[model samples]
Target: MKARWIITAVSAALFFGGSLLTSLRDPWFQNLQRPDWLTFEFLIPFIWIFVWACATISAIIVWERSSKRSRPWYLMGIYAAIALLTSIYSPIVVEFRSLIGGLIVGGLATVLVYILAFLVKPISQKASWLFLPYALWGPIGTYLTWLLIQLNPGVS
Candidate 1:
């Protein structure tokens, strides 16, 4: 459906564009005592593109599979929550420059993803499964961010 693609496109754009617009490659980021494993800073955008792709596909499936009566609820609840979490992650971490704060909030976001994954499984298993990639990225990135923050403690 035209509307489905439009919804997916808009959500993907907001998730990816909003993240890309965050304070990236700043002087502060450059100076962080990043670990050897964190060397692939250049790979973040690509990773995010992949992650958002999964999310977009999952959104389409979820939207299509939801019953007519429940379609609006899925859009407003799961989709909105996903959008909020995806959009806030970078800004919150960048604003505080603190892994502790990031861990707390990012942890919540990750859990919400799992919750949504479970909620959508009965609607569409593929939709639920698609959340896996997005969920997988969270902990690894959170840990790497933790390492960076711990190694470079000057910032709040």
Candidate 2:
């Protein structure tokens, strides 16, 4: 009950912060060699808002669907891992200015998104479905990181 709500609130807050991990206005980011087709910078925050909203709702659904006899600590841990991984990605890339680091973190996050979706499916199909956007975004983000690495070689 109350605990579920608290967990949901915390998840939402953490993901909201994760959404803002990368700064579009940062000089380094602004100077990156982006592809001409990548023109949706302004939509990133909104896209993350939608993704995190889905993730939050999915977590709640999973929580409600779990049996009282067996608490959903595993799911909680997975969610926390994914959220934390997502949060640190931008900082790591920005601080080190390393496209390689970004690519690694992004790929890892994508894998975790798939793992989360797979784990959630058994608990609640609807909840798993809710993770679809995040799952899709994960690969897209990873691809973007890889592209950046390709565009800007020798980026330390």
Q: In TM-score terms, which candidate is top?
A: 2
Report the lDDT tens digits of candidate 1 across residue range 35-109: 886667889878877887887788778777777775746444766676766677676667556656766766776
| Candidate closest to the true structure, highest lDDT | 2
Q: What are the models' TM-scores?
A: 0.84, 0.90
Model 1 is weakest, by summed lDDT over 10 consecutive residues, at 70-79
| lDDT, residue 138, model 1 | 78
lDDT per model vs. reference: 0.74, 0.80
Per-structure clash totals for the candidates: 0, 0
lDDT of 1 at 94: 72
Residue 70 C-alpha lDDT in model 1: 59
lDDT string, candidate 2, 33-142, tens digits: 98788999678778877887788788888888888899788888887787777777777788668778878877887788788899889889998899898888888888
